[model samples]
Target: MDEARWIQQARAGDVESFGRLVRAYQTAVYNLAYRMLGDRMEAEDAAQETFLRAFRHLDRYDPERPFRTWLLSIAAHHCIDRLRRQRPDLPLDPGYLGDEDPDPEAALIRKETRETVQRLLRHLPPTDRAVVVLYYWYGESLRGIAEALGLTVSAVKSRLHRARWRLAQGLEATDEV
Candidate 1:
């Protein structure tokens, strides 16, 4: 994809180059937003804001780091801010699941599990939620998460531990219901 060339051109004020970059990363940015915000519309908005911020701060980006990491860092911070502002208790959209599951019962179980996880995620603080999403769903290493979230590796580890404990507590509480 000649990402370096595109980034160079984009830095030189080539809008088309920037557009290509957006198209390349749009789905990733949107998925991260959707997972963090738990609402399609809000996620869309957050993704747009993340790109806008990225464009505005392209000069600040370090070429030494992977562009995807930098882009997702912007997204994570934006979602965290949006979450902090409203803290909505919106339900996860069931439509997120694909129809590829041929077994109806298994599909139902997966849907229920997804909903339960999303519900538990909603109870976490915004930063903690971001840490959990980036770590588990994105399969990010502790160092990667720490870089993305602007935290120390130790802080990321602590948040993951705390988030797991809280999620376990949430599960127990739900089980009693």
Candidate 2:
């Protein structure tokens, strides 16, 4: 069944239908939450909360809207709220979430690069991080990002600009250091 049919079934209290939706979107939802929260445990919790909230308010979802976008919006808003309630700077273990590959050297380089970027991203305010992640990591268009973030397109552009500038300055300082 298509997403619409599954959504309909889920809305009508079909556990199997809901399970399918969760399975289909779990990786994507988890990735978004992880990128937004910068902590695997916190992202897992946030993703669960995102799905629970979505299931609870499925009726409010507009059928005309894309389901993935709607789902991400919930994740984004949940992450933003959580970030607001906590400090953005919580130190992460350097060895956490290491990626392994056939070529050890290449894998090490990739891991270091990713760690650097994620570390810098942690310095950004939540909404700015959300906009940058959606626009760059997800390759979402400006208008699409605006919708996902519940922000105006202009606001999305401004946030992206400011975030990019901040990231540039941050990376520059890291280079100097």
Candidate 3:
């Protein structure tokens, strides 16, 4: 069944339908959590918590909005909260730890790239990090990101611009080092 059908069934307390929804979105939710939290165990915990919250609030979900967007918003918000609470130290490698490449060199390059990006991301505030993750990693539009993060579109735009500039300056500095 499609997302809508599954959602309707889930709202009706169909365990199987909700299981389908979980199956469909687990990887995406996990990836978002991982990106924001930068720790494998923490991300997994956050993702599980996200799904639990989503299920509890499923009745409040608006069908007019995309289901994945709603779910992602939940994951993003949860990860942001976690980030604020822990405020972990930087240089967290934010790669999809589950991924594997056939070539060792390619894998090494990807690992380095992820480490660089995560280092850049660590400098941003939680809200700015959320904006970057939602926009760049998830392909969310400005409006969509704003809605997901409860910010105005202009605010989202400003954050994105500032965050990108910070990343650029940071990368430039690293290049000189």
Candidate number of the best TM-score: 2
lDDT of 3 by residue, 29-85 (tens): 998888787878888999999999998899999999999999999998998888888
Off-target runs (Cα >4 Å) in candidate 2 are: 93-98
Q: Counting only residues 3 or more apart in sequence or on different chains, how many pairs clash (N, Cα, C under 3 Å) in candidate 2?
A: 0
**Tens-digit per-residue lDDT, 1-177, candidate 1:** 599988989988899999999999998899888888877788899999999999889999999998998999999999998887873755566646365679989988988887888778877898999999888778889999999999999999999999999999999998999
Best by lDDT: 3
Best of the two (2, 3) by TM-score: 2
TM-score quality measure for candidate 2: 0.94
Writing each residue's lDDT as its tens digit, candidate 2 over 40-72 gives 888899999999999999999999988888999
- The alpha-carbon lDDT assigned to residue 141 of candidate 2 equals 92
Rank by lDDT, highest first: 3, 1, 2
The residue pairs in collision within model 3 are none
Judge candidate 1 at residue 24 and give its lDDT: 97
lDDT of 2 at 131: 95
